[model samples]
Target: MNGGGSCSLGSVLCVITGASRGLGKSLAWELCSRVMPGSTLLLVARTEKALQVLAEELTLKYPGITATWVAADLGTGDGVRRTVQAAHEMNGQDTAQRVIIVNNAGSLGDINKYFVDFTDPQEVDKYFSFNVSSALCLTSSLLKVFQGRPGLQRLVVNVTSLAALQPFKSWTLYCAGKAAREMMFRVLAEEEKDLRVLSYSPGPLDNDMQEEVRTHTKDPDIRQQFLIMKESGKLIDCHVSARKMLDVIQADTYNSGDHVDFYD
Candidate 1:
């Protein structure tokens, strides 16, 4: 530990969203393998069963790391509170000197019929709430806990997308949500000097979300774009993406508010 703490990495605490599957799940395993022995993981997701299974697997595989989880619907205020409370409980009065928050959970909501769903209020709300609002709420809540430590290093990784940067017709809502999330972190980075925020694009992956996006699009061009990637085997593996992400974030010169692509 850098701050005269007994635990190396200063009693690291990682709070990860969407921990049950996809990049989130891979990140949990990747972090456990990389971080110090005394690190603690707080996994968040909507499904309890999946989280429980992951917790057991991580605890068994990486006995040095402690794992806990809170299953909550991330699109709601209650979900944010529950996640914060779970992190506090896991902290157990002795907080970690180093905290990492990975905001990985997001939604693509009605990508196929972007125009048809344009009038749907609930769809729009869900897209923003889950993709942008949830991350903001969680980060704000945890900042209070991580601040004022003797040698605190607080880092936030906002899982971003190409949709955020490139304008894709059928993915209007998806693009907007990701873009908003990235900008939020960019602003946060400017305000919080001690907090390091990185908007990371993991590149395309062969995940459930990809499958959904491929099938939902009525637009031939949009559908074919995804189809070509799948057929061409261009999608990155979840575990490989996870490993590279950890490496990139741990780089000595990695700065706050960096818009990093996996290839970079």
Candidate 2:
């Protein structure tokens, strides 16, 4: 309002991991419209180029919206620290009325292998490091930075899947990771009464991960089902799912620890 430029000092602080593409990317766009002028979005991903491009796009398209990108592997402790530090130092933090942390960074794991084939301890631990541990540590650290402010609304969303509830033939790692991550947030919701926690299962999305399932899934039946979904054009669009999630947040009626699926 002072300089006459399009940008404004945003007050909403949103941090999204795995934000380079898919649902995370769509969330960035969807959230931009919902927040008032001067809202900030911190995008986290391992690809620097993708993050940079996204940040520029968000900033350019949405007036008064500030989009920042952090390219780092959230699997490591150092990466978690760097991201938390960046969030703590982000400008206009004092003005923020709301904080959103979306723990969406995850992997399908080695889908080509069956359960018995996954024998190595290091391999299992590595899979869990990124898909499971990263979300836990990163969310806890950011909470410490943004906590203790009265009237400051804090929301944490864990991107989960049906695999958490049901077993898939060759997706042991992915299933276990989703289940563990969902449970973690459920526990958080119980421990932190002020925080709103959501375990959202976006369903089978029409994205790169679905493509991987169609091609690399070791279970013949599961692969065939995914292939059918692709062939029949049944996979859910990322934007559509993102919108549903945004609607859920705005509605704010569900129990904090409940698992809400796209169909639900």
Candidate 3:
């Protein structure tokens, strides 16, 4: 088992997507705090301002570690290419011991509309762009980089939701997107020999996304159910969940083709 603070200087490179806020941000911060001081972290987000702020904060707090912020929309192939370029640039010409890629960026479309009522093709496309295509493209690009590099532990954690297991009625498109992303990682894990790909459902959380679900839900019963879940301590804090994910990455406990659920 890899204990805490196992990495040495400049040995680990972690690329976290959707890192501007919520679980992504929490994960980045946790990693910055726990990992070796001089490790490199590549933060990807759509918001430049947030990413810059986070980069500055990490740099200020942990002066030894290098934090590079890449503002890219991972929903498209071009964005994935840019991310790959940034990762290679960060890695420089030296070979890294470990490359941890966290696919944490996702979107839950307008939850108020039912499957039949939500007929906007654009919205459906957007869902696929952010939730499924982004994860797939990013993983593929990174895996290509990891190939032929021996003695390097590559960890890909696909951040999914419990909805992928238990489908929600109003969130048909969102659930479908998550399910597709999860399956992509699963299949990739089966084919890939070097990298460890894990489809992880981080369970529910007391985060902005949950707040959005609560606010957008028109049904009182649904809202109340979420409220109860939130109040019952079932929802894990973002920081705690992020730390658990980091532990899993460092320990390398998962099989190549594993769907690990935080709740389970």
Candidate 4:
């Protein structure tokens, strides 16, 4: 284990996407303490207030660490490009040796009720953009940046959900998008043998998403099942999941081309 607080300094840079709340926020905090204590963290989230709060907290708590916030919608081409550029700038335009990319931003939706639900097609588009496209785009851009740095341990961690493993009735679009995102990481892992890419499902969490599920489900029995799971403490918390992800990233035990589930 790396002992020094400045372990993240000198050569490491970690980029965390969707770092406003829940698992993303927890992961950002954990990473700040553990792997990259003094490294530069580029936090990407659409919520400016949340990002600002996190950045300020990290700055005050860890004096040596550098926490920068980019409040941008990462589900668009422009957003992805701007995020990559921001990371490059922070890394001094190709000077950083190790870049840890955490693609943790995602969304869930109910597309079963209406196939053409366009109350916010733009929002839905943003979902796909952040969930799938931005991950790929950012990873591709980083790979380009790390092309010549043979000894660098370039890592990309894709945060997925158990929903990708099983099909749910109302979460059709979410399942499809997550599945696509996982497959994209798998393929990228295969294509880039040197770069470490992991597709990880953090399982069900007691977060807003689950609360939404419990509240919105039309079937009482199904909702009860979820409630039972939650009451039984079977549902994982965002912090626990975030810690597990950090362990996986540090251990480098997962197969680059495989999907690792928290349930397993």
Candidate 5:
């Protein structure tokens, strides 16, 4: 509580990306339920309709909560600018609320081709843009808001995956992007004294991304591995996974630059 006010739900401003569906949607709901009165939520996603739907739903569910959304693509520079602008506008400068940025939006880039054999440079760039560059841009943008506000706590939670720590065939782009994001945060944590950054791996969850892994893979073994997780009832529901992740965020046991898995 360096900001003189207690770290209550009301004093926290949450910025969540990739919040249209899947774990992003689930995490939005969880935060809605937990945030205190006067808390504001800024959700970023590509689908305008979905963001509007969520905004309407949250308004109805929690009448007192303030929620806003930016319908822009995180994979592009312009979209990233629009998202940061919207967040900055919604998150007033005068407010002493601690800022929480959750970089949750990501893509499982081209799974059909081997990384070495994949020659489409455009596709490679896109994968990196979605998974790594976008997160970096958004995080850097928000850091501007806290430049002079040392009293306010700045927390960044970058949703990562097991692929960041291990290699997989045909998953070179995805794995490398995740690793880059984690390392970026590790460096950010070391550089900032008042900021707390977490590179959190949510583990295997029953989400659209996992479904893509099961169906979109060219490798039979990779497909079968995800299939086994699904068939064995081992895939965690997005809501449950989100709750566990929140537990880690709330517990705040790890140091500022640490990487944590859901299982850990």
Candidate 6:
């Protein structure tokens, strides 16, 4: 685990999308304890109730760290604006020397439909708006706000998937979106030499999303695969994957923008 369990990410302004549940929620838990006292946690997600609960719990547990929650759908332009504005609000904390933007807001996107059903442009656009476009815009804007300080460090993490590299029969939109976001972060890493970027595939997490895949995926083979993973207790725990991601960040060994899978 390296020093992930003990090391500090310094006083950080950490922004995590999809912070309401699953891996994002777990990441918030792990990061809140690891960052320095004055660190700020800006948690963003579509559900205000969930975000509020998470924010309150974290702040109450870690009184020294400020936890701010912004409830917005990252798919819309206004949602991205609201989130970036919140980041700007937190930027006054000059004590924060590191900024970690975890871009984890994305959807499964019609797992019941195969590629042949993906004929509607609006449907495709909607999927990309949330999965690909929003991430690119949010990450870029946040990076600018967190950038320019000579000593400040920035890490952008894309919660990507095996579908980004491999094809799933019923997950046409999802696979395309993941691939697009992964490439986007890779390009960003190349353009900004100082920033750290990672595309982490957390494996088949035993969560709601996995349950959806198991029950609704159009392809019987793929659906059966997910079912087998769940039944056999082979799916990775969200917290386990989250901790490993933090460990990887603390280790800082992987080349920037590289894709690191849970198994890897």
For each candidate, C-alpha RMSD in Å?
Answer: 3.7, 4.5, 2.3, 3.3, 3.4, 1.0
TM per candidate comes to 0.93, 0.95, 0.91, 0.86, 0.93, 0.98
Q: Worst 10-residue stretch by lDDT in candidate 5? A: 1-10
Tens-digit lDDT string for candidate 4 (46-152): 89999999999988987767889888887778778888788777866454567788888877765334334547778677667767787888888966754547567
Please tell me which predicted candidate would have the highest TM-score against the true structure: 6
Clashing pairs in 1: none
lDDT of 1 by residue, 112-191 (tens): 67565588788788778878888898899987755656676788889999888998878888888889999999999999
Q: How does model 4 score by TM-score?
A: 0.86
Candidate 3 similarity to native, TM-score: 0.91
The deviation in Å at residue 22 for candidate 1 is 0.5
User: lDDT (0-100) at residue 78 of candidate 4?
Assistant: 79
Question: In model 2, where is the ten-residue run with the lowest total lDDT?
Answer: 1-10
- What TM-score does candidate 2 reach? 0.95
- Stretches of model 5 off by over 4 angstroms after superposition: 1-10, 148-150
Better of 2 and 5 by lDDT: 2
| lDDT tens readout by residue for model 2, 1-264 | 012122221257899999999999998887886777768889999999999998998888886878988888998888888899888877445677778899988999999999999989999998999999999999999998878589788999999999999999999999999999999999999999999999999988999989899999999999999999889998999988987887787777889988999998
The clash tally of candidate 5 reads 0
The C-alpha lDDT values of all candidates are 0.84, 0.87, 0.79, 0.76, 0.82, 0.90
lDDT, candidate 3, residue 25? 93
Ten-residue stretch with the least lDDT total in model 1:
1-10
Residues 21-98 of candidate 6: C-alpha lDDT, one tens digit per residue: 999999999998788888998999989999999999998998899999898989899999999999999888787788
* Candidate 2 segments whose C-alpha is farther than 4 A from its true place: 1-11
- Name the lDDT value of residue 2 in candidate 1: 16
Evaluated at residue 128, the lDDT of candidate 1 is 84
Number of the top-ranking candidate, with lDDT as the measure:
6
Residue 144 lDDT in candidate 5: 87
Measured with C-alpha atoms, the lDDT of residue 223 in candidate 2 is 97
Backbone clash count, each prediction separately: 0, 3, 0, 1, 0, 0
Which has the higher TM-score value, candidate number 3 or candidate number 5? 5
Tell me which of candidates 4 and 6 scores higher on lDDT: 6
